[model samples]
Target: MTLTEEFDQSLLPGELILLESAKLFGATNISPNAKQWEYTRKFPIDELRQAIQRGFGSIELPQIFGGPGFSFGTKMRIAEELSKFDLAFTFALIQHHNALVRVAELSPSDHSRELIASMLTGDLIGCTAMSEPEAGSDFSSLKTVAKKVAGGWILNGKKGWITNATDANVCLTYAQTDTSLGSKGIACFVVLGDKEGFIRQAGYELHGAHAAGVGGYGLVDYFVPDALVLYAPGLAFKTALQGVNRARIHVTAMNAGMLESSLSIATQYGENRRAFGKSILEFQGLAWSLANVATSLEAMRSLAYRGARQIMRGEDALDSAAIAKKFGNEQTLSGVAACMQAMGANGLRAEYPLARHLAAAKLLSYTDGTVEMMNERISGAVKKRYVL
Candidate 1:
């Protein structure tokens, strides 16, 4: 049986249908072109537009906003399915969808509403910018400053390591309005990329996952009207934290999906390739290695599902999300390597995705939040929960 069949019984019929469609979309559009995209570092804009046309761009957007309004659990499953084929494209798609959701639900301006209409059609792509050259996890230390003007705010700073930064036309930017208040001084604004002062920086040449369009940009005297403010200083930082739990869970699901793909490829090759007058599967050592990978994949799925359930129930998922991300970070890196080893020399070939998955796995270790950050978060709760 396929890996998804093991858990299909637990999913709702509608969710299953969505998953099937996502799988088909990946096979038709992503898997075939992933190698080429990586080699040339090309952004998959056409495929991204197709995905938006098919409703992947607004999975969790409210029905009132003309979106399918799928549950958060379903969204997580879709993310997993798409990621199995290509994590770079899947990550970019998720970021765009999130930007759409933020504008649709949070922005009160008519200009934002018009942008949402364009985003839904893929005419305009969107992204969030939070990281800077001097600040990553340290949100309170961001140097980007937003000075209040007569009509709105004048933003001046640079953002780095942002997903979809190379091609996005609408940016949800975060900047500090006051230095003394630290994190509380942070605010979020809708900055149009085509405007005068917003400058798109050169894209990064990543070791892998190039389709993600990961890059940075600079805002020099960029002006955002008061109507475009999504979150004021007092609430912007908290809003960002609230989204972290879901983001962590999404990354965990992606790791699980990649592990599943790697295990399947390695297992098939081991069963078919003969060595020493017999299939490699006959060797106890190789069989046990794949078995361990399978076990880890199952555990990863369980943690991802648990975290997703917590978010669906509107419970505080900080601990669960941290645990899930930490476990995935440790297992996926080693697990994919083990799968690559099982195939011997063939694993390193460009035809096989194992090498790519390996690099992406390392990259993901630093995505969302670093493994060290996860440990720091979990350590804070250890005494409260474990001592009992």
Candidate 2:
């Protein structure tokens, strides 16, 4: 049996089904063209439609919202399984889910509810635009402003490094509503892509996750009616922070998937390729390297699942999520790199996915939160609780 098959057999029924769905979707639609799509930096809309048709887009939301009502942990496992085959495609879907979850949680307006209904049906694509060029790690200093108008607000600013920027039908955007209040001044809004002054610029030439359509846009006097305002200044920053802290666990799952795939590829290559009159797997140094990576991958999985479980139990997981995010990113980068080195030059070739995995590992480090941000979260807690 294949390695994936062996792994699936060990899972529970629901998890087995999720893994099977991801495997089927990847084998039939995504895995074959991942390289071509990456080279062209073009997302596969047709494949995405297929994914939606299969109901993968609405995994964790409630059935009332057209979702399958899966638990957070189940959804995270599905994310891990899907990303193992195609990280870019999986990343795009994750971005869609992010917008849906955040909007569902923070938006209390009638219009936001209608948009959520549309998103659940897969008729609308949603994305979050939270990071700006100048306000990445320090979001309190974001230059994007939302000024009150006669009947609504005029948003004037630019957001960079947004996933699904060019093609999403709606955006969950944040802006400074009261600059004098610093972090408390920030507020979230629901901005429709077709509205006047909402302009989508060209996508970025990213080293990895090309199919994710990560790009920037300029909102030149974009008009947002009061009905579209999700959270006001006093509550917006807290909502966004909590949403991101939860989302970090999903990011950890994606990285774990990548590390799993990288290890599988490296193991197969080492066992088959011969050097010094024997398979590379027979060498003590190479075998020990693989052992170390495998250990790290398991540890990452444990941490990610623990964080998910904590969230499912209605507990605060800020510190757990931060630890998982930081360790997962660092370890995945190191483990994937080690796997590539174990395979020698063949791993660096386009024919193999090690090069792609390496690029993605680097990209994952910055998304959601930077390694520095994660460090701050964890260290702040440590100092508060343990310092004399």
Q: What's the CA error at residue 120 for candidate 2, in Å?
A: 3.2
Clashing pairs in 1: none
How many residue pairs clash in model 2? 0
Each model's Cα RMSD: 1.6, 2.8
- Please, what are the lDDT tens digits per residue for candidate 1 over residues 1-388? 5435655656678777877888899999999999999999998999999998888888888887878778887778888888888889999999999999999856556786788889999999999888998899887799999999999999999999999999999899999999999899999998998998999998899899889999999999999998888899989899898898899998999999899999999999999999999999999999999999999998889899888878988999999999999999899999999999999999999898888888888888888889999999999899777785
Please provide, for model 2 over 89-122, each residue's C-alpha lDDT reduced to its tens digit, 9 standing for 90 to 100: 8888878876786667644667767888877666
* C-alpha-based local distance difference test score of model 1: 0.90
TM-score of each: 0.97, 0.93
Best-fitting candidate, scored by TM-score: 1
RMSD over all Cα atoms, model 2: 2.8
Going through the candidates in the order shown, the clash numbers are 0, 0
- What's the CA error at residue 175 for candidate 1, in Å? 0.3
lDDT measured at residue 255 in model 1 versus the true structure, 0 to 100: 92
